[model samples]
Target: MKLLTCPLNGQRNITEFTYGGEYHPMPDHQQASSREWAEHVFFHDNNAGIVIEWWCHSASSYWFLAQRNTISDKILRTFPADEIFNQRVDFAPAPEVSSEAAPTTKGESC
Candidate 1:
């Protein structure tokens, strides 16, 4: 069995934690369209590369962030969510696109 290091609980069985999906910037609901909101709610990149994700320690009910590489399944580091955000990075509002700039297709083009 694999182990995942929790920021608050130290290293523990992977089963002791829950995968909370990739971390993403929350978009402004007032400016976001139905499609943008739906995409944010239902979609994930699932890319085969390093990604920052949210994880919860089931035993302590503590939530934190983990930076891991999906291809190697290796966790690089773990930290409390607030610690990561304490850097004061600004989350800018999503850029507005005109209808002419909107994609005509239903899905991403290869």
Candidate 2:
């Protein structure tokens, strides 16, 4: 079994944690069209590197940010989920991709 280290606590088993998808800005549903909706549901960039993903500490009722090593399923770094959440982030949100830019998968949604 893999291990999960909580930023607030310490090393905890992986069973106590859950994987959350990549962090991105929520698109405005009202202004989004059918194509935009489809893109949002299916088109996500699978970038490899240190990405800040959400980790729910089911055993502790807490959330934290994890620097996930996507290639190996190994965690590089972790900290109190709120450390990144509470900070004044100035990062540009993901680009609004067109539906045509999405992959040609059969019926899977990202």
Candidate 3:
């Protein structure tokens, strides 16, 4: 049986982990176009080489990252997600509508 080491939980059965997908730098959400968004969400290289990916420990429900070799299907290492994403990301809030712009009723009410 194969084993995978969780940075927090130590080494455990491979079945105890779930593969989260290959890691890629995210495009600027505010600046990226619709096509860019779609590509980031839908496209993957699936290259045959060492790549970093996201993984989760099932029992703890803890998420982390892992580096593996696609050709050999070998897991090289694993670490917490915060190691790479040390900074926090904040999104701009949606614009508020004005009272004058409130929607009009479609039918007569009592």
Candidate 4:
């Protein structure tokens, strides 16, 4: 079984945590268009590369950010959610995909 190191609890079973979706900046809801809001709420890159994501410890309900590789499923580092922007990992902005180029299915041909 895989183990995830919790910033507060140390190493623990991966099952003790919940996969909270990729972490991204939120646009101002009041000023954002319907498309922007929808994109923020519904779209995910799910790229087969390293990405930052939110994770919550099921037992303690502690939330944190994790820089993990999607293809290898390896977590490079973990930190508190508040450090998302100030983190020293130097994360680049997620690339935007035009609606015309977005993938539609799990196994659909590109």
Pick by lDDT: which candidate is best?
3
How well does each candidate superpose onto the true structure, as a TM-score? 0.71, 0.57, 0.82, 0.71
lDDT accuracy of residue 1 in candidate 2: 73
lDDT of 4: 0.87
Candidate 4: give its CA RMSD in angstroms. 12.4
Clashes in candidate 1: how many?
A: 0
Best by TM-score: 3
lDDT of 2 by residue, 1-110 (tens): 78888877788888888877775554676577889878777777778876767788887777878888788877888887555456454545778989999768788687
Residue 54, model 1: lDDT of 95
The order of the candidates by lDDT, greatest first, is 3, 1, 4, 2
Across residues 2-98, which tens digit of lDDT does each residue of candidate 3 receive? 9999999999999999988999888897899989989998898899999999899999999999999999989998989998898887889989999
Against the reference, the lDDT scores of all candidates come to 0.89, 0.76, 0.91, 0.87
- For every candidate, C-alpha RMSD to the true structure in Å: 10.3, 10.7, 4.6, 12.4
Clashing pairs in 1: none
* Candidate 1 deviation (Cα RMSD): 10.3
